[model samples]
Target: MTDVPGFPPHTQLLAALARLGQATRMDAVRNAGPHNLSPLQADIVGLFRRGAAVLRQSDIVTALASTAPTISDAVRVLRRKGLVDATADLADARARLLVLTPAGEAEAERLTAFSDGLVEAVDTLPEQDLAAILRAGTRLMRELESRNLIPMSRMCPTCRFFVPDAHPGEVRSYHCDFVDAPFGAAELRVTCPDHEVRD
Candidate 1:
């Protein structure tokens, strides 16, 4: 579907991904708008899903691929809303760690399932398509991280436990030392709590 004449094949794929991202953003708006929170604000809350993440304003800027001023402004708004609090980082006196309040944690948990509709839509695709998309997405993420265009993601390719193509002839080729199990491309995780940096 390379509708853009004279363009490379990747252009079409990138365009398709952008469309999907737009759809997801609209869904985020529908869920966060009523609560007086923007999509980005909701995402900020969601970042604490693993636990009380010891994150600073700069860390959030990197994580979201946003500018420091933008994140700082957003943090100020969040603090005013009582959804988040910035406290002194025990390890670094000069840095302030962003923490979600009880209400903020509740909001974060709620936001986790905001993409349920998107997930259901994806589930409609055939297994082959799903696997292909997962592989492409993982590769794209890796490239972006390598270029520092995006922060390192908790995907299989960047994990200490990942062993790619460990079982070439098997249905599940990749190996994960963390669980001592083999998984296919479709099982690749984009944000895993158990992820450990490869280097």
Candidate 2:
């Protein structure tokens, strides 16, 4: 979409982001095309690939920020494709846990690297741009997630241990109570595996 000349700066920025998002989806579709997987199926597989345990249908729905029926249908398709298997959870006799077959795991591995080329392209950008992207991305994710517009992320800003600009003029500005240390933007985590969400 072309940017409107008279549009405000924020509007223009959002438009650019929307274009990037569309491009990302297009890339995902293209990458998964050879595997005969839709973008959603690929995403599901990727999620499972990252996880160590089986996931419930509801877990898939919540993680993808999708509806129950939608995830159910996708799971059915995946099962039909022989990519996923369902088993009863020991903890809950009625709950069915979804696990990937060997073929599914292989496909998941492929899907995991779909954006590696994009990451290398992004690495060619300036350090300042990279820092700005990390800050802005986490802020936007936090804002959207607060309104339940998207899935939750473990961002430093919303983490209980995070302290912004703890040292005003110091090179290492932000503070992490978890580690009891200050860090610069380069070290700021947009998606911290150890982050605990602030209550």
Candidate 3:
């Protein structure tokens, strides 16, 4: 059954995603306002707080799925604000690795706490439902990355937790050792926060 000008499943999904994105941006703006930081600057600081130690400018671009020029602009603004510092890479003199200043580190801690609190406040889903949603979202992201619509990820296929089926007769063709559960190609996660890199 269909109605004229009605949103299909895809349209509804896109609209939901867009609204979430806008809400997230507003949250960032509100949180960063007191520190005189933009959303991008806050994001960069958050990245470092999340264990990204000394990354190149290109790395930030890739992680944020943003353009080099946009990242450069943000980095410049951050440097000017004394929240970030850069030094030439020893191995590649032409390249620079970014690090957070002492002030930046303190701000990062505050921002991380604020972000965690905000997320906790809005998160109403049960654990099982949240896991299901995360799996589905990661699957969609993987599909997009496979189609070259998004950047490649540190995902299941490249993770130590992944175990490919060794026997064609197996009922489940793939497994996630971490979850101890069977997984299908379409259900494989592309951006699991718990992902561990394969040796």
Cand. 2 Cα-lDDT: 0.83
Candidate 1, position 42, lDDT = 85
Q: Put down candidate 3 lDDT per residue, 102-133, tens digits, no spaces.
A: 98888888886556656785577765576567
Model 1 residue 41 CA deviation in Å: 0.8
Q: Candidate 2's error at 181, in angstroms?
A: 8.6
Worst 10 residues of 3 by lDDT: 164-173
Residue 58, candidate 1: how far off, in angstroms?
1.4
lDDT of 1 at 146: 78
- What TM-score would candidate 1 get against the native? 0.88
Model 2 stretches astray by more than 4 angstroms: 1-5, 91-94, 115-117, 159-183, 187-189, 192-196
Model 1 lDDT-worst window of ten: 46-55
Write one digit per residue (lDDT tens) for candidate 2, span 1-199. 9876798998989999999888788889878755589989987887786554589988899988999999999999999999999999898887799999998988887876647667777779888787778778888888999899988866788889999979999877899999999987767776565678788
lDDT of each: 0.84, 0.83, 0.79
TM-score-best of 1 and 2: 1
Q: Best candidate, lDDT-wise? A: 1
Candidate 2 steric clashes: 0
Instruction: Report how far off residue 181 is in candidate 1 (Å).
Output: 2.3
